[model samples]
Target: MQNLILLLITAGSSSLCACTIQPQAEPVPSRHVSTIVIRQPRGEPGDFIICNDGRVLVFPVAHPKTCS
Candidate 1:
């Protein structure tokens, strides 16, 4: 029937439109070097761990001057 053909055409066009419409992701700012002074009396250089947000890190130190 003509109605059945029209229904099929409408359904196909809706599915094609749904496939073309995609959700976009929000952009995140690029990470840059952010420094924090070692407060502890004994800590070493090059000993660092990154935070979850890709910013704010903790650097452990074993000696006052030499950081490794």
Candidate 2:
């Protein structure tokens, strides 16, 4: 019937419209982190340790410098 042909045509057109190309999402920017390396002291007096949060810990004459 004419109604059945029209229905088929409408369905085909709807499916074709549904197959459209969409714009892709934007890519996120990557972050670069910088790391600082701290060397261990020779257990000498006046030796210091710099923590990750910019805290300075100085060792005494008999103790070793360590970050908690």
Best prediction by lDDT: 2
Writing each residue's lDDT as its tens digit, candidate 2 over 1-68 gives 99999999999999887767555578888698789999886755476779999999877857776677
Q: By summed lDDT, which 10 consecutive residues of candidate 2 come out lowest?
A: 16-25
Model 2 root-mean-square deviation: 12.7
In model 1, which runs have C-alpha deviations exceeding 4 angstroms?
A: 23-68
RMSD of each: 12.0, 12.7
Instruction: State which candidate has the highest TM-score.
Output: 1
Clashing pairs in 1: 43-61, 43-62, 44-61, 44-62, 44-67, 45-67, 45-68
TM-score of each: 0.32, 0.30
